[model samples]
Target: MFNTVLVANRGEIAVRVIRSLRALGIRSVAVYSDADADARHVREADTAVRLGPAEAAKSYLSIPAIVAAAKETGAQAVHPGYGFLAENTAFARACAEAGLVFIGPPPEAIDKMGDKIRAKATVSAAGVPVVPGASDVDIPEGGFAEAAAKVGYPLLLKPSAGGGGKGMRLVHQESELDAAVESARREAKSSFGDDTLLMERFVTTPRHIEIQVLADTHGTVLHLGERECSLQRRHQKIIEEAPSVLLDEATRAKMGAAAAEAARSVGYVGAGTVEFIMSAHNPDEFFFMEMNTRLQVEHPVTEMVTGLDLVSWQVRVAAGEPLGLTQEDVRLDGHAVEARVYAEDPARGFIPTGGTVLAVHEPSGDGVRVDSWMSVGAVVGSNYDPMLAKVIAHGPDRASALQKLDRALADTALLGLGTNIDFLRGLLADEDVRAGKLDTELVDRRLSELISSEVPAGFFVAAAMDRLISLQPTGTVVDPWDIPSGWRLSGPGGITFRLRTGENQAVVRVEGTPSDASVQVDDAEPVRVSARREGDLLEVRRANGVERYRCADGPQRTVWLAREGKSFAFADQEFTLSSRGEAAGAGPVKSPMPGTVLVVKAAEGDVVSAGTPLLVVEAMKMEHTVTAPIDGVVTELSVRVGQQVALDETLAVVSAAEEKQ
Candidate 1:
């Protein structure tokens, strides 16, 4: 076994690899960028190296820097823990040349399967069922239309060298093909550095299912069943589960056999994934999509259900050890489900959010596992992916696992910035989601219903009230150790607390004495709260639940409250509360959540009708244009381009117009 290994990735996966290395008695070396000096993964490594700046293109993707770090640390092997340069064929080959094993498939396999078009051709030739698509070489503007003629309308134009829905588009009309091609090519070039894309006959409603395959240096390959990743948005997976509710015993046997054959055809080694699109409407007809040459983000669900550690196995295989487990030995124990928690807001068009994580408390239970890299007061930079953590749960059956997952998601609490937390919770309760009638287009098809539905305002008010009570000077919230509070009366039973999001302002009514206050937003119900030190960490809860409602900071107070992934913070609004009924409530257009103030669509003098986009706020990797609430004359516009905003912060002001008779 290798004495030491270098992890060539960051965040939760880095921590995951280190844990595995420690269990195997191997020293782990972690590499970090300037933004990651204090990152949890770096802190946990046995030894660490500084790579470069926070920009991934300059730091994480720097192969020479990583190789040098490995040499400096005397690591016998390098583990590309997915993402970054995980599938970079050059990186694998260079590692080999440097006398260090790469803990994944060989460089040859990467090169062969890295290109989607070629991989499909190779696998199809090996008797695997591949989707009917035009090769990248034959994907000219004119050729695309021709291919669609043969392949049929509703064809998919996908980048030959990308994943996660980037640089891909589905065309339903021939007139839209030209523009879609140009746009997809542009995005593909920016993301993958290769503009090559292929065409495929698009399945109307297909389940995004893929089989995990493992290969050994000893010529043995095995498939580890399928994972359902059908529920997605823009090709990015939101919900994933193993032991798919759709597959049957006979279908599993055939898909597994085909997956194994595909691996063998390419002389595959180590771990890889064979992606397929199953027509849920017609399960008998499935087609190959692409192959991932590294560990996928959804690997945890597979891990829990299969009772295996893919990372550990990768290391063992790279060390020239054969895969000890055979197909028959691969037993599917139960069901597993996962939800990715991201630092992006759903209402604001899901744009990536940037802020310091003020507080974080992960969910814990019998079958729940949270893979994360954040603690308290971690600065979230715009240079990286905003995914904060992954929450997974496993059980003997799908229903039990789902119930566990719902509790797990509801239990996770965070403060600092807006997230899609509430959105994910809504997905769990969605009728279609609960029934397993998911497909690649499901997120798009039901985008409105999912985003607009959730717990009532009482929850937000309750959460806000919880934050208020935890902030008292005498009865203050403390870390871990026990601490008491002194009761003191101040100016008013309620004090004025103000929070600014862009140009919008949220005037909240916090009803209580100086010691404790009940938060009432608009006309929402209030929740009880108390905060004091118990042992090592400060604990606060909304009412009396296992979950903790809290905030943490570096120097300044950074606060966060989780609403699914769309948690909100009101640090700028920390003032004494007063009766809201007396103060003249200002007509403020507050930011609905934390996001980027993208565009000020309306000017100060412009009179607009209801539904007119006053300005656009982009959040959680999506774009949303905030519109006018009613027909009114714009009195004052208070925001600009490229501004960071919090929930319920004002955007602009408008005077209501007289009714048209």
Candidate 2:
């Protein structure tokens, strides 16, 4: 094993690699940007090196700087833990030139598989099935329409050198083709510095299955089985599991053998994933999608079933050790499921959210594991991906594992920002999902059903009780009359407090003192309830049962109450919450999340209708269009292209036609 290894990544992946290195008694070095100075990964490493600014280009993606950091820290090996420069052939070659071992496939393998266009051609020539797609050559003037004639409509335009769903778009019609191609190319150039693209026939109903392969210097390659990654949103995998229920024993062996053959064809080494899109309607047929040349984000699911330490093996193989296991030796034991916990709102198109993490409680049990770097007071910004952690569950059978995963998701709680936990819970509870009838479009097809709009009655009750409990005095009170809530003789019939979430508001009434109160939540029958604070927990007693809520109160009267695996935030009206999105008519269009303005589609005084694109803002490595909410005229344009804007900052202002009149 190497004496020291540098983790060329950030956030949870860095922490994960550092943990593995520590287990091997190998010193770990972590590299961070300014945004991650106090990050958990930095704190966990034996030594840390500072990259440049928070921008990924100047920091994590800067190959030269990472190589220099490795050399300076005396790291003998560099582990590119997915994302950033993980699949960059140049980075791997640069590390080799710097005399540092790159803990991944050789540069030749990366060059062949990293480029989607080349990977398809090479794999197809090697007798592996691939998706039908046009190459990365420049499109002729009428080439798109011609290409559509052969490949058919509903094709996918993807950046040849991109992953994680960046710079990819699906076009359903000829009218959408041009714009999709232009946008895909632009995002490709911005993200990967390559404007090259490949057009592929988009699979309508496919199950995304990836085979985890490990190779060594001695050309020993083995497949550790398949993971079902069909639960996706915006082409990004959200839920993944090992030993997919779709594949039979014979089909599993065939797919695994094909994946291993693809690896051997590219002379692959270390940890890599061979991704395939299988027809849900026809489980026997499969097509190669792409190969990720590094450790995957959802590798823990494979780990749980195979009982293999993939990271340690990555290190061992990089140190020129042969893989001890052969094809016959590999076995899949229990079923494992993993859900990605992201800082995003499922109801709002899964747009990235950023804020301080007030509190976090991860699920724990015999079959559950949470891989995370989130901590109280940790700042989640839009500089990178919104994924915060991954919660995984394993059991002897698929049904037991599915149930365990559902329970695990319900037990996990994170506060202080919007998340997709509730959305994931809905997925786990879906009839089709529980039945193992899954495909890539499962979430998107029933997005409305999966998204939650109904707020629980318990949420309001918890909020009202938290407000009353917060009014209690912190110091010792000698007399009962000294308690907070202004207990009076006969005046003040009820203490009314207003609470709002988005457009919904409730006027809660508490008829008695803080300790004992009759709470009427928005004209519902008054319930006799008692509120008491026991340390960080709030106990609320009602007619039927007593509910305990985990509450965290931050400065400015912001309270987060968590119960039954879901968290709700309540702020005292005195401290108004600013709107991060569009306001009412004629108001300013604010930047929803902190990001750089990518394009200004509308100029000042331009007349536009509702849903017309006003500008594009890139954040969390995704582009979101800010459109005109009402038919109006653009009046104030405050931001320029490439300008960095803060959350809720005015990007532009549109005056409604009626308001202007």
Candidate 3:
């Protein structure tokens, strides 16, 4: 066992590795960038080291810096926790050259599997069926059209060097092929420093399944069944489960053997996963997709069913220890499901969101496990992945596990940030998902029905009551005027507050004292309500029933509330009325999030119709186009390509022709 292991990663995976090292009585060292100076992983490790700036190239991906940090800390081994330099063969070799053990497969194995083209070739040579695709590593300019034609339409342009859907583009028509290839190459270069790509047949309604393989220095390899990762958005997995309900015992055995064979062919050691894309129309058929040469973000589901600590095994295998269990000894006990909780908005094209975590209530109980890096007061940023945590549940069967997962998600409370918790719950509750009829395109197809735009009326009521409660004076006073309610002898006695929830505005009127209040939301009938503040929780007793909400007040009359399985933020228009006075109509184009301007599609004096792309902003590695809201002429272009802009900063201004009239 290593006396000290330095983790060359950040976020939840680093924390996970640290916990596993502690369990085995090994000292852990953590490396962090400027953005993660106060991260949970830094606090969890036995010792910590500063890598560099917030940029990945200057920090986590800096091989020399990481190697030096490990050497300075006298770490016997280095663990690359699934991202950053995890699958970098050069980084692994550097650690080995520095006399430090890499807690993963050998550099040779990583090199073979890291490249999608080479990995498919290697696996196919080992008798594993691979998808039919063009394996040409390089394509000359102007040749993409011819190459894409060979692979047929509806194919995928994927970076050969990286995963996580970073450098992937799907094209359904010949017209989209050239642009998709160019975009894929650009993203590939930016993400992996490799412009090489491969074209693969995109199977319609395919199910993503992966087999977890564990290997040792002694050539012992074993498979831990399969995980269904079909529930995905934009080629990234959202929900994953072990012991896929789609696979029968016979199919499972065949896939497991093939995965094991692929591992052995690469001389793989430690934990690696063999991914396959299986057509839903042909249940018994599958093709090799790619192999991830490190621990996966969704490995917990496999651990739950196999009863094995994969991280512990990674360390043991790297230390030249034999895997004690054989193929016959492995047993999958029960069903387990994992939902990735990300700081993203599923309703808004799954855009990444960054904010300070005001509060967090992770679900806990029997059969529920939460692996997270977020806590109250942590600042989520655009420099990294948006994933905040993973909630996993285990049960005796698939149905029970799914039920447990839904309940676990409902109990989760993360305030003051946009998250996919509600979206994940929606996915688990879908009829198609519940019936085990799933595919990679299921979420995208049913996205409209899954994402609810309606905010419950109770939420607005709770927000109103919370704001009113906050206005209470510290001193003990019984006077009605002394309270937040502006009541007078003249006009209506009820005080009306302007609040906005989503796109809907509410005018809430409050009458009577704080203890006994009558509330009327919008134009609805007035309802008598009894409300009391108990610490951070607001208890409201309405005509229907009583409800409790966890509420927190923010600056500028903002209130955040969490109830049931939802978190909402409501802005009070009181401040808007005082400072901004009236709502401004049709302002300039503003950046939604902090990012750099990528493309300026329109210039000053350009006449454009509504919904025309004005400019494109690249933030958090995702591109968002700012479009014209009305048929207008561009009056000013305030931003330039490659210029970084802050959130809400004006990028352009368009004057509507109708406004001029």
Candidate 4:
């Protein structure tokens, strides 16, 4: 085994790799950008090196800087954890040129499998069934319609040079072909530096199943079964599980054999994944999607089920070790499920969120494992991926695993920012999901039902109680005059707190002190409530029952609360404005998240209808288009391309059009 390995990534993946290195007694070196100087991975590694600025192009994605860091740290090998340059063929060759081992597939294999167009041909030649599709070269000039007619409707446009759902579009008919192509090409160029695309038949009700494969220098390859990654949003996977319930033993063996063959055909070594798309209606049929040339984000689920440390094996193979076990020796012990916890808000179209983490509570105990890089006071920014951590659970059966995963998510809490913990719990509790009736579109289909926009009454009550406690005199000073007990010399006093979250607003009225108070939310019946704070937790007692909330005070008088996996950020109206000046006659178009304005679609005085795209804001490699909310002319345009904007910053305004008599 190598004595020192350099981890060329950031966030949870870097922390995860460092953990494996520590377990194997290998010294780990971590590289970080300016934004990640205080990242948990940097603190955990044996040695840390600064690559460059926060911009990924000059830091994490900079091949020269990473290679130099590895050489300076005297690292014997470089482990490209998942994203950034993990699948880049040039990085692999650079390692070889520098006489440092790359703990992944060879450059030739990466090059062959990196391009989706060529990967389909290579895998097909090895007898692995592939989806019927057309490439850019396959289509004649201005012949997209002809190609679509031949391939059939509902086709998928995938960037040949990238994966991870980036630069992918689903076209249901010829009418949507041109726009889809334009968007896909633009995103593809921005993400992968290549706009070349391939079209494939969009399988109805498809289930994403991938087989994990490991290969050695001695040409021995083995499959580690499959993971079901059908639970997704915006084409990105949020939930994954190993030992898919959809596959029987016979089908599992067949898929595993096909996956091994695919790896062997590309001369693949180290850890890789062969992704397949299977139709929910036809379980026996499967089509090859593409092969990831490095360790996957969901590798923990596979590890838990197979009882193998994939990273350790990757290092052993990179050190020129032969296979230590045969295919028959592998046995999946139990089922495992993993839910990705991201710094995003599912209520607002899953837009990325950023803030300082004020508090965190990761679950523990039997059957629960949390691979996280989040810590209190960690500043989460929009400079990179929004994923904060992953919560995985293992059990003897799928039902128990799902149950444990739901319970674990309920116990998890991260205050001071928005997250998808509640959304994940809701997804796991879906009747169809619990029954294993899963498909890629299941989340999208039930998104509205899963997301609750109504703020629970308890949240408002807790916020009021928290404020009431804070208003009381502290430091052993007991002054009856200073007490905010809603007490008066003549009669009882009352305090009112107006709180707002997004479009929802609530007026909380409190009478008396924290121990004995009558709380009423937005004209609702006053209920007896009392609350006490213990560290970050706030215990509130109400007429119904006692509820505990993980609470934290944020900047600008924002109260963050988490209970039962759900989180809320309530802004005290006394300290902040009730609205962002949206009550005026003009409809303001605001940036959904903090990001750079990539494209300005409309200008001042331009008439646009409702839902017209006005600007596109790019953050964390994802683009969200701001559109006109009403049929009117663009009265004001406040931003231009390449300008950095904060969340909810007004980008433009549309004055309502005059009504004709």
Per-residue lDDT over 1-661 for candidate 4, one digit per residue giving the tens place of the 0 to 100 score: 7999999999999999999999999999999999989989999999999999998999999999999999999999999999889999999999999999999999999999999999999999999999998999778898878988899989999999978888888899888899889888988898888999999999999999999999999978999999999999988999999989999999999999999999999999999999999999999999999999999999999999999999889988998989789999999998999999999989889999988999999999898999999999898887898999999999999999999999999999999888999999999999999999999999989999999888898889999999998898887768788888646788878889999876778899899889989999987999998899988999999778999999998888888889999888888774444466443445678889999999999999898888899999988888888888878889899999999999899999887766210
TM for every model, in the order presented, reads 0.81, 0.96, 0.95, 0.97
User: Which regions of candidate 3 fall more than 4 Å away from where they truly are?
Assistant: 135-141, 476-481, 486-492, 574-587, 609-612, 657-661
By TM-score, how accurate is candidate 1? 0.81
Residue 248 displacement (Å), model 4: 0.6
Q: Distance (Å) between predicted and true CA of 43, model 3?
A: 1.2
Question: Lowest summed-lDDT stretch of 10 residues in model 1?
Answer: 479-488
The most accurate candidate by TM-score is: 4
lDDT of 3: 0.87
As a TM-score, model 4 comes out at 0.97
Q: What is the lDDT, from 0 to 100, of the residue 544 in candidate 3?
A: 88
CA lDDT scores, all candidates in order:
0.77, 0.87, 0.87, 0.92
Residue-by-residue lDDT tens digits, candidate 3, 1-661: 7899999999999999999999999999999999999999999999999999998899999999999999999999999998789999999999989999999999999999999999998989999999888844656666778877888979988889989988788899998777677667777787789988899989878999999999998878999999999999978999999989899999999999999999999999999999999999897999999999999999999999988999999998998889888888989999999999998888878877777888778889999999999877788877888899999999999999999999999888878787888888888999999999999999989999888878888888878877777777776656766666666778447677888865667888888656778888888887888788776678999878999887666566777888767888899764344335321335588887777787889999888888898987776667777888768788889989999887678998877676544
Evaluate candidate 4 by giving its C-alpha RMSD to the native, one decimal.
Answer: 2.1
lDDT of 1 by residue, 1-661 (tens): 9999999999999999999999999999999999999999999999999999976777998999999999999999999987778988999999999999989888888888999978988998998998887865865755667777788888988888867677678889889788688767866775667889888888878888899999999989999999999988667898899989899999998999998899998889888889999888999888888899888999998889889998889889989998888899998999999999887766555666667776777889899999999887677765566788999999999889998998888778766666677788888888888888888887777778777533345334433444455554354564522211222365344544555332234556666632354565555455555444332233444545534334343234434444433444435544445555431332567776566676678898787877777886655333456777767777778889888777567889765654211
The whole-model C-alpha lDDT of candidate 1 against the native structure comes to 0.77
